[model samples]
Target: MVGVLVATHGRLAEEFLNSAAMLVGEKEQMSSVCVLPGQSPEEFLELAEKKVEELDTGDGVLALVDIAGGTPNNTMFRLSMTHKIRILTGVNLPMVMYCVMERSDEMTMEELIEALLENGRNEISEFGKR
Candidate 1:
């Protein structure tokens, strides 16, 4: 299974992991990193890299961030140069759930990336009448 890493500002990543666990039971090879107030980008990057290293077990890691241009995303981008991981921004509950429930050890990196994007997109919709 592809390892999942949720990185975001404040406690958002932690909260998302908690919620995902509640919805789909506990997940293995999954972790979260939060960039707290006054925390430097380098600090966040170091923490995130540790988590990624811990979670990764041959199968690559998947990182989800709250914002595209925020500290977490930027740090992830920098780390991507040296790690075998993919970062997805604008992470939501559905996206987390999809990744947790759908990913498997047999799936390739490209397939996992496509599935994450497809499921995340499909989860969004206009509930009210058009």
Candidate 2:
């Protein structure tokens, strides 16, 4: 299974993981890192690297962040250069759920990343519109 790492500002990453667990039950090979206020980039990088190493099992990892160009996203981008991982921004419940449900040994990292992008995009809709 491809490991999943969620890094976001404040408690978003933790809460998002909790919510995903509530919907799909507990997930294996998944972890989260919360970037708190006043935290330095070096601190965040250290935590992220640790999580990636812990989750990675030679199948690579998927790093999800809340927003593109944000600290979390930027840190993940840098980390990706040194690790076998892919970074996905704009993370939401649907994206997390899709990762949890679709991740497996049979799925290649490229395939999983493509499916996640497609699923995350297709899930977005404007409510009360027809």
Candidate 3:
């Protein structure tokens, strides 16, 4: 199965996973990293790498970060050089739920990323209209 990693500043990463678990039960090959205020970039990168390794199950890993230019996203972008991983930004509850439900060994990383990119947008609107 493909692993899903949630890395974000503060506790957003942990909460996103927790919320998904509450709705979908516990999921395997999923991990979360909360980058604290005082955490060094090197330290954060190290922990992130460990999580990526733990989550990888031959299908490669998908990293869902809070934002594009943020630490979590940037670290994964850098790590992608040495690992088989894809990174996506603009994480939300809907995306987290999709990750929990759709992630699987049968799904290619490119397919997953494309689906999320498209689905993630459709999931949002003016609070009334599509």
TM-scores of the candidates are: 0.94, 0.95, 0.93
The TM-score of candidate 3 is 0.93
Listed per candidate, the RMSD to the true structure in angstroms reads 1.2, 1.0, 1.4
Compare candidates 1 and 2 on lDDT and give the better one.
Answer: 2
TM-score of 1: 0.94
lDDT of 2 by residue, 5-33 (tens): 99999999998889988999677899999
Once fitted onto the true fold, the runs of candidate 1 whose alpha carbons sit more than 4 angstroms away are none
Instruction: Give per-candidate clash totals.
Output: 1, 0, 0
Query: How much RMSD separates candidate 1 from the native structure?
Result: 1.2
lDDT of 1 by residue, 1-130 (tens): 7888999999999999899889996678889999999998888888999998998898889889999999999998898899988989989888888767877779887887888888888888988858
Off by over 4 Å in 2: none
Q: What residue pairs clash in candidate 2, if any at all?
A: none
